[model samples]
Target: MAIRLRVLLALGCALLTAGCASGSEMTFRQDKRLTIVSPGTGKTVRLPVKVSWTMRDFTAVRAGSPVRAGTGYYAIFLDKYPMAPGKSLGSLVTNGDCAGVSGCPDAAYLAQHLNVFVTSGTSYTIDAVPSSGTLGSSSHYLTIILVDGAGRRIGDSSWTTSFTVAGAAS
Candidate 1:
Protein backbone atom coordinates (compact mmCIF):
# COMPACT_ATOMS: atom_id res chain seq x y z
CA MET A 1 0.00 0.00 0.00
CA ALA A 2 2.76 2.43 0.81
CA ILE A 3 4.57 1.71 -2.44
CA ARG A 4 1.36 2.14 -4.40
CA LEU A 5 0.67 5.47 -2.72
CA ARG A 6 4.15 6.71 -3.56
CA VAL A 7 3.75 5.70 -7.19
CA LEU A 8 0.45 7.55 -7.48
CA LEU A 9 1.91 10.65 -5.86
CA ALA A 10 4.88 10.62 -8.21
CA LEU A 11 2.59 10.22 -11.23
CA GLY A 12 0.42 13.12 -10.19
CA CYS A 13 3.43 15.37 -9.65
CA ALA A 14 4.91 14.40 -12.98
CA LEU A 15 1.64 15.23 -14.76
CA LEU A 16 1.41 18.64 -13.13
CA THR A 17 5.02 19.40 -14.02
CA ALA A 18 4.46 18.42 -17.62
CA GLY A 19 1.40 20.65 -17.89
CA CYS A 20 3.26 23.67 -16.50
CA ALA A 21 6.08 23.14 -18.97
CA SER A 22 3.74 22.54 -21.92
CA GLY A 23 2.28 26.06 -21.58
CA SER A 24 -1.47 26.61 -21.33
CA GLU A 25 -3.57 26.04 -24.42
CA MET A 26 -6.65 27.52 -22.75
CA THR A 27 -7.81 30.97 -21.57
CA PHE A 28 -10.45 32.64 -19.45
CA ARG A 29 -13.41 34.47 -21.00
CA GLN A 30 -16.10 36.55 -19.36
CA ASP A 31 -19.22 34.57 -18.50
CA LYS A 32 -22.10 35.36 -20.85
CA ARG A 33 -25.17 34.79 -18.69
CA LEU A 34 -27.81 32.51 -20.24
CA THR A 35 -31.07 30.82 -19.25
CA ILE A 36 -31.59 27.19 -18.18
CA VAL A 37 -34.00 24.88 -16.36
CA SER A 38 -34.06 23.35 -12.87
CA PRO A 39 -36.53 21.65 -10.56
CA GLY A 40 -36.81 20.38 -6.99
CA THR A 41 -36.36 16.63 -7.04
CA GLY A 42 -37.23 14.33 -4.17
CA LYS A 43 -33.66 13.29 -3.37
CA THR A 44 -31.37 15.57 -5.35
CA VAL A 45 -33.38 18.68 -4.40
CA ARG A 46 -32.58 20.93 -7.37
CA LEU A 47 -31.59 19.29 -10.63
CA PRO A 48 -30.00 21.18 -13.46
CA VAL A 49 -31.26 20.77 -17.01
CA LYS A 50 -28.84 19.65 -19.69
CA VAL A 51 -27.90 21.78 -22.72
CA SER A 52 -27.83 20.79 -26.36
CA TRP A 53 -26.99 22.33 -29.78
CA THR A 54 -24.18 22.87 -32.23
CA MET A 55 -21.47 25.49 -32.57
CA ARG A 56 -21.40 27.47 -35.81
CA ASP A 57 -17.96 28.88 -36.21
CA PHE A 58 -18.50 32.50 -37.29
CA THR A 59 -16.71 31.86 -40.52
CA ALA A 60 -19.31 29.20 -41.29
CA VAL A 61 -22.50 30.87 -39.98
CA ARG A 62 -24.92 30.96 -42.88
CA ALA A 63 -27.07 33.95 -43.86
CA GLY A 64 -29.93 32.66 -41.71
CA SER A 65 -27.60 32.94 -38.72
CA PRO A 66 -26.28 36.32 -39.73
CA VAL A 67 -24.72 38.49 -37.03
CA ARG A 68 -26.99 41.40 -36.21
CA ALA A 69 -25.33 44.69 -35.30
CA GLY A 70 -26.77 45.11 -31.81
CA THR A 71 -27.15 41.42 -31.00
CA GLY A 72 -23.98 39.55 -30.03
CA TYR A 73 -22.96 36.03 -31.03
CA TYR A 74 -24.43 33.01 -29.26
CA ALA A 75 -22.49 31.04 -26.60
CA ILE A 76 -23.83 27.53 -27.08
CA PHE A 77 -22.32 25.66 -24.10
CA LEU A 78 -19.14 24.63 -22.29
CA ASP A 79 -16.60 21.80 -22.83
CA LYS A 80 -15.17 21.85 -26.34
CA TYR A 81 -12.04 19.78 -25.81
CA PRO A 82 -11.58 17.22 -28.58
CA MET A 83 -9.68 14.14 -27.58
CA ALA A 84 -8.93 13.54 -31.24
CA PRO A 85 -10.91 15.87 -33.53
CA GLY A 86 -14.30 16.33 -31.91
CA LYS A 87 -14.97 18.23 -28.64
CA SER A 88 -16.77 17.89 -25.30
CA LEU A 89 -19.50 20.23 -24.03
CA GLY A 90 -19.10 20.85 -20.31
CA SER A 91 -17.77 23.40 -17.81
CA LEU A 92 -14.08 23.55 -16.80
CA VAL A 93 -11.48 25.72 -15.08
CA THR A 94 -8.33 27.44 -16.44
CA ASN A 95 -6.18 30.60 -16.33
CA GLY A 96 -4.03 32.98 -18.43
CA ASP A 97 -3.26 31.66 -21.91
CA CYS A 98 -5.85 29.04 -20.99
CA ALA A 99 -9.10 29.08 -22.99
CA GLY A 100 -12.22 30.36 -21.23
CA VAL A 101 -15.71 29.17 -22.11
CA SER A 102 -18.48 31.74 -22.63
CA GLY A 103 -21.48 29.92 -21.18
CA CYS A 104 -22.18 29.92 -17.45
CA PRO A 105 -24.60 28.28 -14.98
CA ASP A 106 -25.37 31.25 -12.78
CA ALA A 107 -26.43 33.72 -15.42
CA ALA A 108 -29.55 35.65 -16.29
CA TYR A 109 -31.16 35.07 -19.64
CA LEU A 110 -33.83 36.91 -21.60
CA ALA A 111 -37.24 35.57 -20.64
CA GLN A 112 -38.97 35.09 -23.92
CA HIS A 113 -40.85 31.80 -24.15
CA LEU A 114 -40.36 29.68 -21.04
CA ASN A 115 -39.86 31.22 -17.65
CA VAL A 116 -36.14 31.63 -17.05
CA PHE A 117 -37.02 31.87 -13.38
CA VAL A 118 -37.49 28.12 -13.23
CA THR A 119 -33.73 27.80 -13.46
CA SER A 120 -32.60 28.06 -9.86
CA GLY A 121 -29.68 30.45 -9.63
CA THR A 122 -26.27 28.78 -9.61
CA SER A 123 -22.82 30.12 -8.70
CA TYR A 124 -20.12 29.19 -11.18
CA THR A 125 -16.63 29.77 -9.80
CA ILE A 126 -14.17 30.46 -12.58
CA ASP A 127 -10.96 28.80 -11.51
CA ALA A 128 -7.79 27.62 -13.24
CA VAL A 129 -8.61 23.96 -13.90
CA PRO A 130 -8.38 21.50 -16.75
CA SER A 131 -10.54 22.31 -19.79
CA SER A 132 -11.06 21.08 -23.30
CA GLY A 133 -9.71 23.70 -25.75
CA THR A 134 -13.05 24.65 -27.29
CA LEU A 135 -13.65 28.39 -26.96
CA GLY A 136 -11.02 31.11 -27.31
CA SER A 137 -10.48 34.74 -28.26
CA SER A 138 -12.37 34.96 -31.51
CA SER A 139 -15.56 36.39 -33.01
CA HIS A 140 -17.84 33.42 -33.56
CA TYR A 141 -21.52 32.41 -33.66
CA LEU A 142 -23.02 30.38 -30.80
CA THR A 143 -26.48 28.90 -30.41
CA ILE A 144 -27.72 28.25 -26.88
CA ILE A 145 -30.39 25.60 -26.43
CA LEU A 146 -32.17 24.21 -23.38
CA VAL A 147 -32.94 20.54 -22.98
CA ASP A 148 -34.46 18.22 -20.39
CA GLY A 149 -32.65 15.38 -18.67
CA ALA A 150 -33.82 13.03 -21.43
CA GLY A 151 -32.39 15.34 -24.11
CA ARG A 152 -35.55 17.04 -25.26
CA ARG A 153 -35.91 20.70 -26.23
CA ILE A 154 -38.07 22.42 -23.63
CA GLY A 155 -38.66 25.97 -24.79
CA ASP A 156 -39.31 27.45 -28.18
CA SER A 157 -36.88 30.24 -27.40
CA SER A 158 -33.24 29.74 -28.35
CA TRP A 159 -30.37 32.18 -28.56
CA THR A 160 -28.34 33.22 -31.60
CA THR A 161 -26.06 36.03 -30.68
CA SER A 162 -22.69 37.47 -31.62
CA PHE A 163 -19.93 37.36 -29.00
CA THR A 164 -16.19 37.80 -28.74
CA VAL A 165 -13.84 35.75 -26.54
CA ALA A 166 -12.08 38.69 -24.88
CA GLY A 167 -8.52 37.35 -24.61
CA ALA A 168 -5.03 38.47 -25.42
CA ALA A 169 -4.15 38.94 -29.09
CA SER A 170 -3.10 35.56 -30.42
Candidate 2:
Protein backbone atom coordinates (compact mmCIF):
# COMPACT_ATOMS: atom_id res chain seq x y z
CA MET A 1 0.00 0.00 0.00
CA ALA A 2 2.89 2.35 0.83
CA ILE A 3 4.47 1.66 -2.58
CA ARG A 4 1.17 2.38 -4.32
CA LEU A 5 0.81 5.70 -2.45
CA ARG A 6 4.37 6.73 -3.45
CA VAL A 7 3.59 5.86 -7.06
CA LEU A 8 0.47 8.03 -6.98
CA LEU A 9 2.42 10.96 -5.52
CA ALA A 10 5.02 10.63 -8.22
CA LEU A 11 2.36 10.66 -10.91
CA GLY A 12 0.79 13.80 -9.40
CA CYS A 13 4.14 15.60 -9.45
CA ALA A 14 4.73 14.62 -13.06
CA LEU A 15 1.31 15.96 -14.05
CA LEU A 16 1.99 19.30 -12.39
CA THR A 17 5.32 19.60 -14.18
CA ALA A 18 3.68 18.79 -17.49
CA GLY A 19 1.04 21.44 -16.88
CA CYS A 20 3.70 24.08 -16.25
CA ALA A 21 5.73 23.15 -19.34
CA SER A 22 2.69 23.21 -21.60
CA GLY A 23 2.00 26.90 -20.75
CA SER A 24 -0.96 26.14 -18.51
CA GLU A 25 0.45 28.58 -15.95
CA MET A 26 -0.57 32.22 -15.87
CA THR A 27 2.45 34.35 -16.71
CA PHE A 28 2.13 37.95 -15.64
CA ARG A 29 4.03 40.28 -17.94
CA GLN A 30 1.90 43.19 -16.78
CA ASP A 31 4.34 43.84 -13.98
CA LYS A 32 6.83 44.98 -16.60
CA ARG A 33 6.84 48.79 -16.32
CA LEU A 34 8.58 52.00 -17.24
CA THR A 35 8.86 55.27 -15.26
CA ILE A 36 10.04 58.74 -16.19
CA VAL A 37 12.66 59.84 -13.68
CA SER A 38 13.47 63.40 -14.70
CA PRO A 39 11.55 66.59 -15.52
CA GLY A 40 8.69 66.04 -13.15
CA THR A 41 5.23 66.39 -14.61
CA GLY A 42 3.88 69.96 -14.74
CA LYS A 43 7.36 71.38 -14.23
CA THR A 44 8.82 73.92 -16.61
CA VAL A 45 12.10 73.06 -18.21
CA ARG A 46 14.65 74.44 -20.65
CA LEU A 47 15.86 72.94 -23.91
CA PRO A 48 17.88 71.06 -25.05
CA VAL A 49 15.76 69.16 -22.56
CA LYS A 50 17.06 65.84 -21.31
CA VAL A 51 14.47 63.14 -20.58
CA SER A 52 15.34 60.01 -18.64
CA TRP A 53 13.47 56.95 -17.41
CA THR A 54 13.72 53.64 -15.57
CA MET A 55 12.63 50.27 -16.91
CA ARG A 56 11.68 47.21 -14.90
CA ASP A 57 11.14 43.63 -16.04
CA PHE A 58 11.87 44.59 -19.64
CA THR A 59 14.85 44.63 -21.99
CA ALA A 60 15.71 47.48 -24.36
CA VAL A 61 17.29 46.38 -27.63
CA ARG A 62 18.59 48.28 -30.60
CA ALA A 63 16.54 48.92 -33.69
CA GLY A 64 16.66 46.22 -36.40
CA SER A 65 17.04 43.34 -34.01
CA PRO A 66 14.81 40.34 -34.54
CA VAL A 67 11.38 40.88 -33.00
CA ARG A 68 11.19 39.04 -29.71
CA ALA A 69 9.04 39.02 -26.61
CA GLY A 70 10.01 41.35 -23.74
CA THR A 71 12.75 42.90 -25.86
CA GLY A 72 12.50 46.28 -27.57
CA TYR A 73 13.35 49.96 -27.57
CA TYR A 74 11.74 53.27 -26.66
CA ALA A 75 9.75 55.53 -28.97
CA ILE A 76 9.45 59.04 -27.64
CA PHE A 77 6.54 61.15 -28.88
CA LEU A 78 6.31 64.88 -28.44
CA ASP A 79 2.92 66.36 -27.69
CA LYS A 80 1.37 63.19 -29.05
CA TYR A 81 0.27 59.77 -27.92
CA PRO A 82 1.59 56.67 -29.62
CA MET A 83 -1.34 55.10 -31.41
CA ALA A 84 -1.46 51.98 -33.50
CA PRO A 85 -1.13 52.89 -37.20
CA GLY A 86 -4.52 53.41 -38.90
CA LYS A 87 -5.90 54.50 -35.53
CA SER A 88 -4.09 57.78 -36.07
CA LEU A 89 -5.79 60.52 -38.03
CA GLY A 90 -4.43 60.79 -41.59
CA SER A 91 -2.16 57.84 -40.88
CA LEU A 92 -1.52 55.86 -44.04
CA VAL A 93 -0.70 52.76 -42.11
CA THR A 94 0.85 49.85 -43.97
CA ASN A 95 1.79 47.77 -40.94
CA GLY A 96 0.21 46.55 -37.72
CA ASP A 97 1.07 47.11 -34.07
CA CYS A 98 3.01 44.51 -32.12
CA ALA A 99 0.79 42.12 -30.21
CA GLY A 100 2.39 39.87 -27.61
CA VAL A 101 5.75 40.39 -29.38
CA SER A 102 4.39 39.49 -32.79
CA GLY A 103 3.31 41.56 -35.84
CA CYS A 104 5.97 44.24 -35.25
CA PRO A 105 6.32 47.26 -37.52
CA ASP A 106 9.48 48.15 -39.34
CA ALA A 107 11.36 51.39 -38.76
CA ALA A 108 10.09 53.13 -41.87
CA TYR A 109 6.45 52.36 -41.19
CA LEU A 110 6.70 53.49 -37.60
CA ALA A 111 8.41 56.71 -38.58
CA GLN A 112 5.72 57.51 -41.08
CA HIS A 113 2.82 56.89 -38.72
CA LEU A 114 4.12 57.36 -35.21
CA ASN A 115 6.51 60.32 -35.60
CA VAL A 116 8.66 59.15 -32.75
CA PHE A 117 12.28 59.40 -31.68
CA VAL A 118 13.55 55.86 -31.37
CA THR A 119 16.21 55.06 -28.84
CA SER A 120 17.57 52.07 -27.01
CA GLY A 121 19.04 54.12 -24.19
CA THR A 122 17.16 55.25 -21.10
CA SER A 123 17.73 58.98 -21.78
CA TYR A 124 17.14 61.28 -24.73
CA THR A 125 17.70 64.98 -25.35
CA ILE A 126 15.14 67.16 -27.09
CA ASP A 127 16.98 69.96 -28.79
CA ALA A 128 13.95 71.90 -29.99
CA VAL A 129 10.50 72.46 -28.60
CA PRO A 130 7.63 73.19 -30.92
CA SER A 131 6.08 76.65 -30.71
CA SER A 132 3.07 77.03 -28.43
CA GLY A 133 -0.23 78.44 -29.67
CA THR A 134 -1.38 82.05 -29.53
CA LEU A 135 -2.58 81.44 -25.98
CA GLY A 136 1.14 81.14 -25.24
CA SER A 137 0.50 77.85 -23.61
CA SER A 138 4.02 76.37 -23.51
CA SER A 139 2.75 73.18 -21.92
CA HIS A 140 3.57 70.02 -23.83
CA TYR A 141 3.06 66.34 -23.34
CA LEU A 142 5.87 63.86 -23.81
CA THR A 143 4.98 60.19 -24.08
CA ILE A 144 7.20 57.14 -24.21
CA ILE A 145 6.14 53.78 -25.59
CA LEU A 146 8.08 50.55 -25.68
CA VAL A 147 8.37 48.88 -29.06
CA ASP A 148 10.06 45.83 -30.50
CA GLY A 149 13.30 46.27 -32.39
CA ALA A 150 11.21 46.13 -35.52
CA GLY A 151 9.58 49.36 -34.26
CA ARG A 152 6.22 47.90 -33.34
CA ARG A 153 4.46 48.97 -30.18
CA ILE A 154 4.73 46.63 -27.20
CA GLY A 155 1.94 45.68 -24.86
CA ASP A 156 0.45 48.63 -22.99
CA SER A 157 3.90 49.78 -21.89
CA SER A 158 3.60 53.50 -22.36
CA TRP A 159 3.99 56.54 -20.10
CA THR A 160 3.23 60.26 -20.44
CA THR A 161 4.21 63.39 -18.56
CA SER A 162 3.63 67.10 -19.06
CA PHE A 163 6.05 70.02 -18.79
CA THR A 164 6.29 73.59 -19.98
CA VAL A 165 9.09 74.33 -22.39
CA ALA A 166 11.06 77.39 -21.44
CA GLY A 167 10.95 80.04 -24.16
CA ALA A 168 8.39 77.99 -26.10
CA ALA A 169 5.74 80.69 -25.96
CA SER A 170 5.26 82.41 -29.26
Query: Which stretches in model 2 have alpha-carbon errors above 4 Å?
Result: 1-32, 85-115, 133-136
> Which candidate achieves the best TM-score against the true structure?
2
State every prediction's TM-score relative to the real structure. Answer: 0.22, 0.63
Alpha carbon lDDT of each predicted model: 0.31, 0.70
- How many clashing residue pairs are found in candidate 1? 19
- lDDT per residue (tens digit) for residues 14-123 in model 1: 98888674336654343334433221111122112233223332222211233333222222333221111111112222222224534322223212211222121132
Model 2 C-alpha lDDT per residue in residues 40-115, reported as the tens digit of each score = 8988898887899999877889987888888988888877667673232223243434444443344444444555
Question: What's the CA error at residue 74 for candidate 1, in Å?
Answer: 14
User: Which window of 10 residues has the lowest lDDT sum in candidate 1?
Assistant: 38-47
Q: After superposition, how far is residue 49 of candidate 2 from its true place, in Å?
A: 0.9
At residue 130, give the lDDT of candidate 2: 62
Candidate 2, residue 107: the lDDT equals 45
